[model samples]
Target: MNLEECRKEIDRLDKELTNLLEQRMQVVAKVAAYKKANHMEIFDPRRERQVLDKIAAMAQYKELAPYLQKIYQCIMDESKNYEREYMKL
Candidate 1:
């Protein structure tokens, strides 16, 4: 494919990713509500580790593991931040 085609494909994928992220944030909102009601902290190191490990394992290419982990770490960090803000912490 040409550079323009590649960019277009990326843009298409990005749109899908944006939609999925919005869905994930909706669930995160629910999680925040649950945690707030239960008086639980937003950060769960063990769960974060499990998520990172799971995504790493699920990665199709071994070389992609670290990159995927980094991306997910950022996602989890933002989720925590959203949870805090939602809970007024």
Candidate 2:
């Protein structure tokens, strides 16, 4: 594909990513409510490890595991922050 075509594809993917992120954040809201109801902490290290391991296992590009981990860490941190805000803590 040409440069313009590649850029258009990226733009389309960006829109898709935005939609997915919104959906993910909605789920994060639900998770926060569940945790609060159960008096559970927002940060679950074991779950985080499991998520990272699962992502790493499913990753198509092995070398991108570290990058994916970094992105997921940021996402998890944001989720925790949202939980805190939602809980008014």
Which one is best on lDDT?
Answer: 1
lDDT of 1 by residue, 1-89 (tens): 99999999999999999999999999999999999999998999999999999999999998999999999999999999999899985
Model 2 global lDDT (CA atoms, 0 to 1): 0.92
Q: Which stretches of candidate 2 lie over 4 Å from their true place?
A: none
lDDT of each: 0.95, 0.92
1-89 in candidate 2: lDDT tens per residue? 99999999999999998899889999999999999999999999999999988888889999999899889898899989998998774
Counting clashing residue pairs in each candidate, in order, gives: 0, 0
Model 1, stretches more than 4 Å misplaced? none
- Tell me the RMSD of model 1 versus the true structure: 1.1
